[model samples]
Target: MTVARRLIPCLDVKNGRVVKGVRFVELRDAGDPVACAAAYDRDGADEITFLDIGATHEARDILLDVVARTADQVFVPLTVGGGIRARSDVDAILRAGADKVSINSAAVKTPELVNEVADAYGRQALVVAIDARRVNPLDPAAGWRVYTHGGRVDTGLDAIAWADEMARRGAGEILLTSMDRDGTGEGYDLALVRAVVERVAVPVIASGGVGTLAHLEEGVRPIARGGGGADAALAATIFHDGHFSLSEAKAYLRARGVPVRATEEGR
Candidate 1:
């Protein structure tokens, strides 16, 4: 049986404000996280991702308050990431109502951390966030490389290979974001999404470059057909700016023959 593809709306929080931009640079304030999350939930978003883009190297808290407030208001799943470096940090976020905690730089720096969290919180609760950018556009073999520290620092690791290793190490899911497509609204990097999806057995959530319904359809259909595509597609700017509601996005995908949840069918 084919499973329905997921649609996720991402909120990049910095100083408690939802922000987004291209290449993880030039971030612009979108709105308050809690309010934005509530809106997405009401719009029938399958899940929502809250990334504390500024919590690293500064704030030690994992935006528990934001998570708590959002959980109180939203009915769907919530995945929290950014500044999740320690086991306690993961615990705090989960306790505050996050369905999953995504780890990036910490997981890259200490691969064992993925296993540790998976063992303590269960595999389904752990997600490895991979922020990747095309460092060498001229080289077709250059491939997407993982970036850490809120997409500011390059890890020099191949994104596809890293995704495979993370899955082997017990990561339940992969939130793969393309720095090049992020906030550009041009569309997701289908090539990059295909690369990671083909290499990993776990679910892959494609992020960045979802400017229109067509982009979302492109990302979700490929994955629903098989690993050679995207299982879910996430957006920040498009959803944040109110270009279209989550319900509209899902309807568009379903009409295009993508296997997406019909939660928005009535609405």
Candidate 2:
């Protein structure tokens, strides 16, 4: 059975505001996190991912208040990440109304945390986020290197191997972001996506570098057809900037024969 693909709008929050930039730098204000999420929900986003992009780097907790407020406003599933160092952090984020918690730096630092969260909350509630940059940006075949702390620190772990390890440790989903492609709007690193998807049994959400609706379609295209074969496609700049709406994205994907959950408007 073909699992319906999901469309997720990512909110990279810093100091309680949604922001965007190229390769995770020069971030400009995007909008209020809650408003952006509500808008995505209204437009028929299958899910919303709210990442506290600064928390891990700043050595602070994620804005739980914002998480709670966004939770109150959006009906779709919310996945929150950043500064998730311990099980307590995951517990708090979940209590803040996030359906799942995404962990990156902390997961790399302490792999056991993945086990703890999965054991306590079930694998469904644990998402391991991997931010990867190709070792040779000029060569896609060079493989990818993992980076954490909002893509600032190189973890020296092979992206594909790390993803497999996380899935082995009980992560229900892998949120794979191509740091080199992030905010570039070129497209996803389909090679990286395919490598991870081929290695892991868990769902992989391909993120970063989505510039066009065609990119979204390509993200979920079958690997056999030279596409990412991702379970979900996540974008921020395109959706946040009004380049397109979720309804339009869904319509585009459907027109291309991708089975996506219909939005209320599309329905």
Candidate 3:
């Protein structure tokens, strides 16, 4: 049976406020994290992601209060990332009502964290977000490299290799973001996404460069069709900027032959 593709709205939070940026820079105030989540929930977002982008960059903990608030109101699954370092962090986020926690930098700092958190909460609750950038413009063969600390620190880990390792270590899903395409809205880096998806057994959420509803449709178009065919599509700016609604995007994808959950299913 074909699994229904997911349409997720990502709210990147910094200091308790939702923000959007291009290629991880020049972040602008988007809106309240809680309010944006509630709207996406009502609009039929398959899942809601609240990433505390600055928490790790600033060496602090994610705003648990904001996580709790967003979780209390949003009915769909909620995944919170940023500042997740140890078991206590995961426990706190879960306690705050997040259905899952996404870990990036710490996962790289202590690769064992993947096993630790996945073992404690079950792999289904752990997602490893990989921020990948092309190492060689002339050829993807040089491959994409993983970056940490909100895309600031290059970990020198090969993106595809890291993804494979993360899955083996127990990540239930992979949140793959192409740093080069992020916020650019040109569309997802299919080459980068396909490389990881083809290598991993876990679900991959394709993020960045989603400027139009067509981009969402394109994200999951299937590698066989020359698209990355990510299990989920995540966008921060378009959804937050009101360029499109989750429902409208899903409807568009469904109409275009992408198998997506009916809005009523989430209801």
The per-prediction tally of clashing pairs is: 3, 0, 0
Candidate 1 clashing pairs, residues 3+ apart or interchain? 222-229, 223-229, 223-230
Which digits, one per residue and each the tens of the lDDT, describe model 1 over residues 1-267?
A: 498889888888887666753222122333667777776776778999988877554443537777888899898889998877788888888999999999998999999999999999888999998999986755536798999875789898989889999999999999998888887888888788888887989999998877888888888666456423777888877776666778888778777777777773533
Q: Write the per-residue lDDT of candidate 3 for residues 30-71, one digit (tens) a residue.
A: 366777777778788889998886645332344788888877
User: Cα lDDT for residue 113, model 2?
Assistant: 92
- Give the lDDT of residue 259 in candidate 3: 88
**Model 1 TM-score (2 dp):** 0.88
Q: Could you tell which candidate, 1 or 3, scores higher by TM-score?
A: 3
What order do you get sorting by TM-score, best first? 2, 3, 1
Residues 1-267 of candidate 2: C-alpha lDDT, one tens digit per residue: 467999998887887767663222122433667777776787799999987866453323437878889889888899998777787888888998899999988898999999999999999999999999999989878899999876899989999999999999999999999999997999999989999999999999999999999999999999998899999999988887766888999999999999999766897
lDDT of 1: 0.81
Cα error of candidate 3 at position 203, Å: 0.3
Candidate 1 backbone clash number? 3
Output the lDDT of residue 97, model 1.
94
Regions of candidate 2 where Cα sits further than 4 Å from its true position: 20-30, 56-62
Top model number, TM-score:
2
Q: Give me the runs in candidate 1 sitting further than 4 Å from their true place.
A: 20-30, 56-62, 223-228, 264-267
